[model samples]
Target: MTTSNGSSGLFISFEGIDGSGKSTQARMLAQALEQDGRDVVLTREPGGSPGAEEIRALVLQGDPDRWSAETELLLFTAARRDHLERTIRPALAAGKVVICDRFADSTRMYQGLSRGDLRAKVDALHELMIGQEPDVTLLFDMDPAAGLARAKSRATVEERFEDFGVGLQEKMRAGFLALSQEFAARFEVINAARGIEDIAADVLARIKARLP
Candidate 1:
């Protein structure tokens, strides 16, 4: 899967509501791919590059209402741009499969719809700044309530979004499902309401089918 930048690399992003097990699946996939002799760069959004990591602390560690939706959108875009330039693009150019825990789609749902109707703005900014999309987006689908419970159990400092409660999780799940339809060609939906190994096996199979 060659990216838009002409890099002959497969860019896969894992996306789902908080605590949907997408992160765990992403790590497992990276390891599996590495064991297969593929050069894999496992990373995450809002914190891939050094600059992006700094921005991540600001956006993720503060109060839920620390920044308004608009402000948060700008912050996320900045972080993504830095991540693309410093980490993602370079790895792709070197012909590495980059497995990202989250990407633009998260911002599209979190900042675009979670707070208000700013999806258009998000799209516009993305086009103007970071124009690259993953070659494949794996959407881990599961019950929002269950996912929230899992997320809250983590007790991580990045609980700002989780603090918004189940309502937001429900909305994010719906928006992500809609987004899968919107970008169905590159979107692969997986049932996340299962054991880790089972889900990882399903993910690896799908990814293998897509590999060039």
Candidate 2:
């Protein structure tokens, strides 16, 4: 997890299955960095900026049959563009530590696993929109079955992806692992099958070691 400019400012993203504890860890990491006197901007994909939030609702709440795989990919990219332009990129340029709960990787994994051809289009759009990548990405590696169980136990309502069958979730988990390997230098896989504090501690240690 090396940084190009020695981490005076950093952009970190969290990726994982539905219940992989990314949001919790992302918040904890951001708070820890803030305590260390680093300016931190905590945000999430699909619902960061105002425009993106609207798209998020449509994507997560609207009828899945209304959207094709290609449409789903485009909608995710649309939200991402808004998020990057309005929230992420600005914070990074201002020398703030940007910790995003999810980013482009989620789209790649979900859409890649579900829609084969759409994956390539999403990748191309990602390159066009988010020209600069995250300095570090923490991947919460956990079994899809366990993650789904945890997610269902925690949530009263299921989002569109949450409603996806176990098989798709398993495939998405595999996609994440494969993507992590492909970007080994920038992506760190964290064992997320532990207590929250334990996971947070490990994540903190990883970030501290990577940051200048």
Best by lDDT: 1
Q: What digit string (tens of lDDT, one per residue) describes model 1 on residues 1-212?
A: 56655788889999999989998899999999999999999999889999999999999987899999999999999999999999999999999999999999999999999887999999999999999899999999999999999999999899999999999999999999999999999999999999999999999999999886
Candidate 2, residues 92-146, lDDT tens digits: the string is 6677888988888888887755656567777788888766678889999998999
Best by TM-score: 1
Against the true structure, candidate 2 reaches a TM-score of: 0.93
Q: State model 2's lDDT.
A: 0.83
Candidate 2 clashing pairs? none
lDDT of each: 0.94, 0.83
Clashes of each: 0, 0
Name the lDDT value of residue 78 in candidate 1. Answer: 97
Report the number of backbone clashes for model 2: 0
